[model samples]
Structures are given as structure tokens and as C-alpha cells.
Target: GLRNYVQMFTEDPRYWRSVVTTLTYVVIAVPLQLALALVVALALKGMKRGKAFYRSAFYAPSLLGASMSIALVWRAIFNDGGTVDHLSGTGGWVNKPGWALLAVALLTVWQFGAPMVIFLAGLQQIPAELYEAAACDGASKWRQFLSVTVPMLSPVIFFNLVLQTIQAFQVFTPAFAVSAGKGGPADSTLVYTMYLYDRGFVASHMGYASAMAWVLLVVIGAVTAVLFRTSRSWVFYASEGDR
Candidate 1:
């Protein structure tokens, strides 16, 4: 019975579509989020004024993101006549699936402060002498960033990558809240975790939902393994001291 349900849903095109949508979200969101975080962290490093306040302001959204009340607030803000649509002067855009996806993407991007804080901590640990040495050698700032900062930060980057990948794959609240549970006018916001919720709880397809969960685990594992394999080429371990 369980295997049958698992096979049934896994074979369904709609189920696959949800998986693809979620994966696409991760593909587009995670890298851009990390890039933006890294840039902000770099810029904020060594700043003498208002650092604490700035860091707290950036991280505030992360603390609010998963709360039920906060989700409700987001729902109100993205509803058909909510602040966003009103500001854009496009009341109908909320019903458009593409815009729904973009709305979810924006929410995801706005939560970048957590990763940026992590990156800031990582950047601070890097010795200034490394940058000074680069400068002495007439290395451009961009070159110094690539050759020194990136290499030194590889471990931190890898850590953030793995953590964010797992989190992004399981993103549900924003999509559910922003799209108002219909997954939007065309199901554009139907992320995999939301699909699993619908199947397990909504449809009472517990066995099938369990299968989907296992499949998600496998997919995450495979992606992480690929990242680790690729890291050998780029990830610099300080213990090796080989540069």
C-alpha cells in the first residue's frame, strides 16, 4: 500500500513539477542571496560606526520569518490589494503566477541578513596582513579579493552553502503565506515542501508523503556530495597551509 502510493505520486507529472519548481527556486535564490550577503559582509567589515545596530537590523527579519504572526503579516502584505500591489499600481499582478514566484523570491532575498552576518564574522577572522601583502605586491583590489579573501573564506562559504541549501529546499512558509495557499493563480508558488504538506496532511497521503520526504533527503544528499566533490578544486583548508 505504501509503495503503491509512493510510486503513484512519484510517477505523477504534477508531483515532478513541484519538485522542479522548488529546485529552481533554490538554484536561483541561494547563489544570489549568498553573493549579496558576501558583498554586504565585505563592505561592512572594519566599519567603526553603528556596526552593532546595523547587524541587528539586518538579522531582525530572520528572527521574524518563521513566526505564525509574521507569516500572517506577510500574507496581508502580499494579498490582492496589499501594500506591494498597491505600490506597484498593478492590483492584478498578485494573481499572475510569475509575479507570485517573484514575490516569494523577494521574501527569500530579504532574509539574507543571517547569512551576511555569518559571512561578516568569517571576513573579520581573515588577517589584515594578507591584504596588506597583496597591496605591497601591487595586486588590484579585485585580484586580492579573488586570490586571498575567497580562498580564505572557502570553509565559511562551504558552511553557508550547505546550511542555506538545506533551508532553501525546505522553504514553505513564505510561499504558502505569499501565495495564500492556492500556490497562486497558476501554481507557480507550489514548492515541494508545500506539496508534501498538502499530500500528507491535506490529502491524508501519509505513506506517499513519507516517500517524498525520503526522496527530498536523497536529493539534498546528492547535491551536497556534488558540492563537496567540487570543493576540492576551490575550497582552501587552513590546516593544509598550502594556499
Candidate 2:
């Protein structure tokens, strides 16, 4: 059955368009989210006052982000007559394709807590002496950060990149909840996994969906492999070869 459907879905331009849509979202959302998280992590490192409070505050949204209640809240915020539209005053921004994609991106960006926390922990483990040593050598903050901070944190960054990329590729709940399962306003928000759901469950094209699932697995695996191979030149493991 999958054999039959694979041939059909592959030949269908509409199905490929759905695949491209999902890939585009993952490519944009994942990197931007991680970059923002890294910046937040850098800011929080070594702060003395209100550290616990701030960390918790930043992390709270992520913890609750995927919950049904939170998804409903997001839906309300982006609805036609919602606060975002009222603020923009454009009357129908949410219904527009560009704004709708942006709204989804914002939803993904809001869940930065996990990666931020990971980066914070990684930043903490980096020795303060490294910074001090760089300072004594007359290295500017930017230079020291480039030469030392980045190298030391490369392993952590690599880990987060891989994990988050996979998560972004598999994203479903936010799109489903925010778009109300219709993918919204002209299928602009339809992600690959959501498409898979439509095919497998809604359309009862189980075989086709299964093939798409495997294709997704292969695509993710290939991307991950590329990251790992590229990392050999960048990621500096402290325990190199001890494993």
C-alpha cells in the first residue's frame, strides 16, 4: 500500500509543496530561536541580583507553552480580533500570510527556556579565568568571546543545535492549536508533520503518511549527520578521546 502511495505522493506537486513548507519553517525557526536563546544565556551568565527570579521567569513560558491551556491562550492572542491585531491596527494582519507565519515564528520563539537554560549551564562551566586571561592579554571582549567563549561552548551549542533542530522539524502542537487544525488562512501554516497527520488520519492515506514519515526520518538524520561532520572542525570536547 505504501509502495503505491509513495509513487503517488511523490508525483503530486501539492504534497511536495507541503514538504517544502515544513522545511522552510524548521530552517527559519530553529536557528533564530537558538540564537536568541544564546544571547539570553550570555546576558544571564554571572549575574548576581535576581538571578533565580529571572531564570524562572524566562523558563516559565516554555514549561507551559505546549499545554492545551497555553495553546488556547496563544490562539486567542492571534485571533482576528485579538490584542495583536488591535495593537497593529491593520485590521486583518493575522489573516494575512506573512503575519500568520510571523505569528507562528513568535510562538516558537516564546519557547526558548529549555535551550536558554542549557546554554546558561554551559556558560557557567566556562572558567572565569579564561576571560581574565584574555583581558590580561589585551584582548577585547569581542575577540575573547570569539576565541575562547565560543570554542568552549561549542559542544553545548552543538548539542542544542541538534536537539532543537529535531524538535523544530517535528513541531506540531503549536501549529495545530494556534491554527485550529485547519493550518489557517490558505494553508500557509501547514507544517510537514501536520500534513502527515492530515494524510494519515484525516485522509486515511496511512501508507502515504508512513512513507512521508520515513522520508522525514531520513531527512533529519541526514541533517544531523552533516552537523556532526561539520562539528569536527568546531566542537571542542573536553573529554576528547577518553570515551
**TM-scores, each model vs. reference:** 0.91, 0.92
> Per-residue lDDT for 240 in model 2?
82
In model 1, what lDDT does residue 152 have? Answer: 97
lDDT of 1 by residue, 1-243 (tens): 666867797688768878878988998889988998898888788688988898888888888877666776766777678887789877744477767676677677778888999999999999999999999999999999999999999999998998899899989998887777767667788899988998899999888789889989998899989988988888898889754
How many clashing residue pairs appear in each of the predictions shown? 0, 0
Model 1: colliding residue pairs? none
lDDT of 2 by residue, 42-103 (tens): 88886889888888999988889878788768878888788887897775444776666667
Evaluated at residue 91, the lDDT of candidate 2 is 54
Give each model's whole-structure lDDT. Answer: 0.84, 0.84
Candidate whose TM-score is highest: 2
In candidate 1, residue 177 scores what lDDT?
79
CA error at residue 179 for candidate 1, angstroms: 1.7
lDDT of 1 at 203: 93
